[model samples]
Target: MLEVENLDLHYGQSRILYEVSFQAPKGQITTLIGNNGVGKTSTLKAIAGRHPASAGTITVDGTLVRLTTAFQAANAGIAYVPQGREVFPMMTVEENLETGFACLPKTDHHIPDHIYDLFPVLRDMKARRGGDLSGGQQ
Candidate 1:
């Protein structure tokens, strides 16, 4: 399980999040829904360690996580597909997906077959640069 409690965030004294709390259990989908500027992305950023929270507790798999960086969150099994589909524009489709292996240990550093199953088009365009793909294809 992943848990967040009393999360507060600020950008140099301009507060963004306030007392946010939630829980996501394994094998379930948890969606964060809100109007614009309601802290949805901020909350994900905080959990993904892109930004530090002013006050909060984040727990994963019954262990308290001290999220000091985005890599740490990835190591803790937190995968973030940031807004705007931030794929590497300069790299090929295969290269872009290969970037995800950075979070895994060497023994597990290969793309899984299920990924191709999920995005079948990627299999055909593995040699094509990400920038050449349309926004919808991305």
Candidate 2:
């Protein structure tokens, strides 16, 4: 289960969230809905450790989580894929996928062919630099 309690977040002195709370039980889908400028993305960012929460406690299962950095969150098994896919400009698609090795065990370093099956264009463009791909391809 994921639980967020009395969450508060701010930018400089501009407060963005206050006492925001929610629960997402395991095996169930949860969605956040809000209009523009309502701190929706901020909430996800805080949970993903992309930004620090001013005050709050995030718990996964029953353990309190202190996400002080994005890498910490990722190591904790939380992934944040920003709206704009941020790929290495100089790396090829194959090389970009290979970078996932950093977050996995050496035994799992090989890229699975299923990924190429799912996105065949990536296989076709594996040698192309990430910066050269069209926006959709990225």
Candidate 3:
């Protein structure tokens, strides 16, 4: 399970989140919903380690995580794909997939056939620029 408790986040001197708390059990998806600029994205950013929480704690499978950097978060199995799909607009589909290797060991860097199997369109458009694809495809 993933657990967040008493979470707080800030940008510079401005506080963005206050005492946020939630739990996402294993094998299930949890969605965060709120109107724009209501700290929803900030909450996810904190959990994903894209942005550090100023206070509070996060645990994955009962182990405390030090979400000090994006690499640490990725090692902890936390991936934050920001809204607007932060793919490099100039990169091809294959190159975009390669970017996921940043969180993986060198031995695990190759694209798995299963990925293409799961997203056949990606395989067909491997040479296409990310910006050329529809939002869902990206």
Top-TM-score structure, candidate number: 3
- Candidate 3 off by > 4 Å: none
Deviating ranges (above 4 Å) for candidate 1: none
True-structure RMSD for candidate 1 = 1.9
Among all windows of 10 consecutive residues in model 2, the one with the lowest summed lDDT is: 68-77
TM-score per candidate, chains pooled: 0.86, 0.85, 0.89
- Model 1, 1-138: lDDT tens digits are 999999999989799999999999999999999999999999999889989999989899999987877668889988788898788899999999888776778999788999999989999999999999999878
lDDT of each: 0.89, 0.89, 0.90
Overlapping backbone residue pairs in candidate 3 total 0
Highest lDDT: give the candidate number. 3
Task: Residues 1-138, candidate 3: write the lDDT tens digits.
Answer: 999999999999999898999999998989888888989988888888878899999999999987777778889988877876888889999998998888889999899999999999999999999999998998
Of 2 and 3, the candidate ranking higher by TM-score = 3
For model 1, state the Cα shift of residue 50 in Å.
1.7
Report the C-alpha lDDT of model 2 over 15-48, residue by residue, as the tens digit: 9999999999999989999998999889999999
**TM-score of the candidate numbered 1?**
0.86
